[model samples]
Target: MTTDPKSDGGVTQSPNRPFGLPRWVIGVVPILLLGLVVGGFVATTPLAGVDGGEPLPDVSIDYTTLPNDDTIRLHVTNNAPEPVTISQVHVDDANWQFEMTGAGGDRTLEPLESATIEIPYSWMEEYDYSVTVIADNGATFSTTIVAANSSPGLTGQVVWTLTVIGFLIGIVPIALGIMWFPFMQTMSKKWLNAMLAFSAGVLGYLIFDGGFEAFETAQSVPSGYSGPLLVVLGISGAWLLLQAVMDWLTDDEGESRLSLAYSAALGIGLHNLAEGLAIGAAFATGRTSLGMFLIIGFMIHNVTEGPVIIAPLADGNRPSLVHFVAFGLLAGAPAILGGWIGVSTQSPLLNTLFLAIGVGALLQVVFDIGDIVRRTGSIRSAPNMMGFAIGLVFMYATGLFTL
Candidate 1:
């Protein structure tokens, strides 16, 4: 009996599409285009509120600084849907004359626009001061400066200092942790499984810690950006994107142990990046004690991550020295980059987004480690359970130093 090439047992099959694209793309493209068109129409049309009520005013004090003994600088953003005109500035309940720069010199801020306002006033050091900004619509926004101090600026010497701190906090301890690979090689199968579970436990704690930080950071973002929604989107987007990438990388048998190790390292690296940002921000804001404590705390907390990255390869074919170095850098190097960014720029939106992404990625890594443990032995086994508990407790104990 002769059968058509495109038919299976008398059932017709759909022919391959052009360019080997997935069938779902055929439906998705049109819907996406339609959405874009509708969005464009709505954005271009200036429709008043449905109730015809007056537009509300929203302005955010992004940053404040004391440039000198007699100068107070403020970075302000107009988050309102309508334009806002800055009419007056008040310091400690007294009206003060100020100069405006950026976003048109007319002291008018268009929607979502930002400007810098400089007030010439003698501010006392170590004294609390409150500044209030008034717009033409009778709306007021205020911010307080506690123990006022000059903001730090980036210079050659400052850059070098931050780099050294990043290296010590982010790289040195992780390298020390990687030194345990040789000893881990001699462990039995049960012990190896326990170690893997321990790694998962450490990561689980990080997910909780990072998620909490993300939420707190979100509170600082401008209301126009919907900070809470941004966190949700960042977390969900990162989790789904990483999952898709992992799915693409897996073969018919599933993900290899080496790939899982690399994923763990990547997740840990992102977490370290957020840690570095915190350290940089603290130092930049003159919180020297806070920065010192963060450095000490992170040094202790990150050491455990090195072992976690190499745990999957403990029983497999031995990796070369280069591979070991690569793994360490992958798990620890982003702290340096994060420190530079946090110190150089003060953007709550960016900080919140990065923190959310780190939390999401680490959460995915925890699940991957759990799968690895399940494949080796029963997850509920005494050794694995005990190891998990110990790991969690160890991280919590080390984390206290930061607080």
Candidate 2:
């Protein structure tokens, strides 16, 4: 037996330690830190301040552009202690040029009741204005209303056909993931490890951007914490929902790589649905140029998604063709479904829901990729970090030029 120069007789000297924490402490500390991060974000977020209790004469007004006209639908919800009567609604502009009278001269809204009324204004440019809502009891407030980006009108057969075609094209990128079905053997373990990290990076960006958009969308409506609350629920709830299903499906056989792939597919599918909504909405609003552009850009962006879902599968032996198709549908079908709904109507609540769900699911996939890399002791490797950064940059650049 030979002792190195650092060793004194038979006793070996310890390597220089930085934090001086034990190996187990170092390993366990990250989990503790993660918990703290989640806790802090929840505690500090505005969602914690959401009040759902009864109110006295409090009201909320949410607005969205109606299809096929220069009409804006104002959804008014009353949060008062008693029945309230609304006398008038006028755009608080200098000219006071736009107004909406109470429906059939019936404007009384019972406590916790809602009313939807339309305001018509023909302006090709984005109309930004404050609508002054008045109740007979003298409670009044002005809500900001912005016009829809796309011009929605007359979606006959031609527009409908184009919308359907655009939606189908959006799903094409998701299906492209099937190409990973072959030659898993060609990629070595190191290569697989790098790809998994790369997958994590791409998912990370989506989650960040998606979550932000969901929160911002709700905030725009000034709808208390409902938006952020819904987003948080979407993320955590979807995670729990998928986990329960995955356990039920694979508990007997234990989790397989295909199951993980399925999870990734499911998350990406929800996200892609949002993309489809964007395309459908553009065309539904009569913006053919923007709709086609979004489809093209999203299609290009989606090319990377297949590999994201399939990267984890590379850890296992070659997966069957059935597995690939199943994964594709699990992730890709939502886009088609979302397009149909988006074309008919645009709902902010639903938009936040899907985006949040995607954020949640995608986060889970990222965590899963991290677990794989950790288990293989490649998480901190240079190749792993390089792959992750490259993936993040590549996805971002694709998004920059396309989305």
Candidate 3:
């Protein structure tokens, strides 16, 4: 009977494979895994560091006593393998005196050696300043002083202002997205393609030109980095994080794209906050030119980000003003945070690293949204391409590329 059945191929049929996995199961896992990996990389990888660590030479400044009457004692140590030289000491008041016992201007010492610098000053109010240190190997480190009795009032006010400004600016994206929705929907595929191409151009230019330049400028300001190796790693890590996040929020094959949209928005928000901090901090620390540049560049980028936020909502067949505002807030709050952080810390390495992360994250975002936009309508439309070109023009006009 078995032979007959086999030979006859009676109704050749295979046993059912336990419902492999719902479509969601297939799509969700890979996407989730990818996203998680990307997030991990973004969080952990030091793209702006030396050998994946903080780039500046390691040096410690110890204060022996608080400023009371006569003088405040402090000690500076070179902890890294390289020789560190004290380039400049900036104190607030003239009453404060800086005395370098050893070779002051360009003193060179091997790692683990200590130098005692006495700052004899009598001041009732607490103070802060930047001390620039140059390594024998030409690595520079700039550390900002934070007093134990630092005034939180001034700092708190600055933080509050930044938060308000960020919140306000965030609304623009939501508005722009809504206003342009009708226009984008009517565009032809060719136009759409043009738009995407334009978007790609802007992002590409920013990453290769603006992003790289920012990193170099950062390296120049305070001696940092072992070279391009760290920069490449940083870029890779950022991409990995972006991929991980996208995968995490994406559903199974052919599933809804809402989760990914949400995740991207969240990432964008976090990114903006970091940017805001950069602007605020630079202004706070007397880097107005740099701060202004970042603000203008980001503002343009944020405008484009608005459309990305709403695309998901549209896909779900639901769009509302309330949700728009909420997304705006989520996206915009970062400016304030970025501003505050930038102002608070005087670490050039930290600032530059954060900037690189922003660049990386933004690149991921452009790619993710571009994918969505293309699928919605054909990318072969004229208007759509024009829109994208307009966006790119903004970037270029702002000198984001030249920087």
Candidate 4:
């Protein structure tokens, strides 16, 4: 019997079957397409907030006092339209006396208008006095009057020292980020996930706590606290920008050496800038312990950050030693800069804002790194989790969570 060329026994095959899609094309194409879709979604979500431009309160005090003896004078200008009243006034010393002299009893002040209260005291000698004023609306303001200590020399020096230090710490991390990538790609997926999780925990805790605490703290020092809204918006905006960067870095070819190097470095640079500002502000405010605490926790966190940058590069045929060290320096240098900046700035508001931005960056880092861990299929999950727990405990012990 003569059989057809297309048929073997009862089985028939088409010519087009031999040229059909390869197995990898069938599997990998779908996966790549899916990854692209998921990546887009991840990039758009706002992971945290930033700090900028919150309206500050305007407060002024007017008074006349005798030498050595202090008299309290309270004048408040309410920029916001509303009635304001003074509930109580506390003077640093007994030589000072306070009394309401304008508006109504108990020092009632109208919005956009100023009210005056006077404190009369007996003159003794040269002495500096601090005045604490509390308003009925839960606003508090404090000012120090220098009788003999009002030297322009010391004030200028203090301001200069703080300003320089603040700027340095704020930008250091960005510098470090430039070279952090090549090393991160070689880290085990398990360790990367652990670090990522730890970062997320720290940032999440800080965002909820730090953001609210900053606003409350600001209210204590100034009449009108402005900037909380900015903090929230900034966090969202920064997160979106980071998401954009992540999307760009993760595009076709799956995290190349150059893209990994640049994206991580840039993200870290911004992260360090904010960190520096925060540290500077803390030091400026005479909160050395608090500033140190923040830096130490972040530093531990920074060590893990290097690994995150390096691990993604593993797929590119295992990064070389040169790339590893270069990325490490890039990721680490910013921490140094951030540390210096933190030591300089003495502004409480700046610190608050910096904290907000830091929180945002940490969130982004955690999620971005976590994505890598999930894809890489971790082997040492337990040990990596231990590392993450250790990191968290270290942060808690450092008093970073203390308000």
Compute each candidate's TM-score over C-alphas: 0.85, 0.73, 0.56, 0.48
Model 3 worst lDDT run, 10 consecutive residues: 12-21
lDDT of each: 0.82, 0.70, 0.55, 0.51
Report, for all candidates in order, the number of backbone clashes. Answer: 0, 2, 40, 40
Candidate 2, residue 174: how far the Cα is off, in Å: 2.0
Residues 145-168 of candidate 3: C-alpha lDDT, one tens digit per residue: 554232222356767766655654
Q: Which ten residues in a row have the lowest lDDT in candidate 1?
A: 12-21
Question: Candidate 1 on 1-403: residue-level lDDT in tens?
Answer: 7887877667766765423456788768889999999999799875644578768889999877776778898889898899999999999999999999987879999988988999999988788999999998789999998898765666677677778877877787788888999899999989999998898888888888888888898888888899999989988888888877887886533336677778888888888888778766765555545466677787897789888888888887688798788887887888887778877766778888888888788777777778778877899999999998888999999998777
Between candidates 3 and 4, the TM-score winner: 3
Per-residue accuracy of model 2 over 1-403 as CA lDDT, tens digit each: 6667666655555555325546677788889999999999988896757887645566667444544346555667665666767776676553233334443356777665666656665444455657777777667856775544544543476356645664455457767755754554478888788888888888888888888887886663335336788888899998787767766676432254567788898898888788666656655555556556655666777777888887876655666778777777777777777766676655666777888888888887787678778877769899899988988898888787565
Task: Rank the models by TM-score, top first.
Answer: 1, 2, 3, 4
Name the candidate that leads on lDDT: 1
Pairwise lDDT winner, candidates 1 and 2: 1
Q: Indicate whether candidate 2 or candidate 4 has the larger lDDT.
A: 2
Residue pairs in steric clash, candidate 2?
Answer: 57-80, 151-285
Model 4 spans > 4 angstroms off: 1-78, 81-128, 132-226, 248-250, 256-275, 282-302, 314-349, 378-387, 398-403
- The candidate with the higher lDDT, 1 or 4, is 1
Mind sharing the TM-score for model 1?
Answer: 0.85
- lDDT preference between candidates 3 and 4, better one: 3
- Off-target runs (Cα >4 Å) in candidate 1 are 1-51, 252-255, 290-294
Model 4 / residue 324 / CA error / Å:
7.1
| Top candidate (TM-score) | 1
